[model samples]
Target: MSGNSAERAGELEVVLVKAGRTKIRYRSELLLDDGNHVAVRAPWAGEGVRDFGFVRFEPGDVFTEHYWRDRWYAVKEVRAGDGTLKGWYCDVTRPAVRDGAELVVEDLDLDLWRSADGTEVLRLDEDEFAESGLAERDPEGATAAVAALDELEKQARAEGGLTALLA
Candidate 1:
């Protein structure tokens, strides 16, 4: 179904899981479909001391995740329970798949994070991604993943940045 229809119907449920554990799940009221990318926002599920690269969540967090069908990267904006913006977390992953009730991403173990104001960029988990054997198995994909992180960082510093892209 098109994103507009999914948004109007309020039936788009996205579940994000990694390594057999669910990281987050939410029902989205608006889904943006821009040919190759889809974006959705909702309050994060559960409560924990969740850590992005440059920030941490106490108990509650709301997030907007933007997924690209062709790119191996997804950008997520983290916010506090009170709706205070925190930062951006970008995940290098396999292209997302959208099923009837879910959207799945196979995270590639590499991530990028920047503070709320586009300062302090961190590239995280490089060792993990290397140890995961993804590079040996798919060298081209690994290269693309790194390139995606670079491009994401560039976007984070752009005039409109991710917020405009999501909007």
Candidate 2:
């Protein structure tokens, strides 16, 4: 699978480790080799920038257990940076609402897409998010952040950090 990844075109192969049933995290290496296959160039390069004919991850995203692997993502026409291509990260999660500084919210349901030039554009469900007044958080990041914060607070209290602060 990594062999064909555009992110692995001129560099190390993209390797994905399983995080859970829903998603697998992969580290994609990018190296610009114009004469070869993946033609990733710097963003500064103007019109000559490589053109991405198809965006695989953005549209037909499918999760599967392939080659006896746990779970994998199949993105077609995937391009990486330096090849003047952008990458996308897509997911759906809980929503965030803000009340005060106590709640530092972020977007949660952020489906990300990258152009060949490395511009990350988000894929969002407008109607769903708008209904929640998610001005402070996206469904993905905000939800994850809050959950992590909760854990942090718990650990801090366990370590007596909160009590120390009061002193």
Candidate 3:
């Protein structure tokens, strides 16, 4: 999974190991690949990023990422690793790609966080995404990406919305 080789795209599992620890803690499935970037869907562990401190992994903190090539943003469902619902985290970025046997996402830095109950929604890293000049490069796609986030947030707040998709 580490060579400069490309495979005939199909179903694949991307193992996410803890930064320092060697054991695999998560697996994201790549659902599709169209010679460009592969689409991955999976539950990701959530650790606070803004505070700039050590991130402690909780027992049941997970976010389900729904990634696709047609959309510029990937919508995710935040939940406990044990399946307790939390909220949503959206990342605005270029479509994912399959690097060797692994799926790679170059996160564009902009993100949106919404509480599980739909009460709090925060758009993160606006400055960074803007600084990257993605909007200037492709204004329409950038705007549509943000719109996709809005739509995903609304759907995530509904009962059985995100989890069903994950299933």
77-143, model 3: which lDDT tens digit per residue? 6556677666666776556544466654446566777666666666677787667676888798678
Q: What are the candidates' C-alpha RMSDs? A: 3.7, 17.4, 6.9
TM-score of each: 0.79, 0.23, 0.56
When summed lDDT is taken over every stretch of 10 residues in candidate 1, the lowest stretch is 45-54
Order of candidates by TM-score, top first?
1, 3, 2
Q: Give the TM-score of candidate 3.
A: 0.56
What is the C-alpha RMSD, rounded to one decimal, of candidate 1? 3.7
Top candidate, metric lDDT = 1
Where model 2 places Cα greater than 4 Å from the true spot, the runs are 1-86, 92-109, 130-142, 145-167
Residue 64 alpha-carbon offset, candidate 1, angstroms? 1.1
Candidate 3: worst-modelled 10 consecutive residues by lDDT: 48-57
Candidate 1 per-residue C-alpha lDDT over 72-149 given as tens digits, one digit per residue, 9 for 90 to 100: 888888899888888888898878887754677778888888788876778888999878887788899889988987
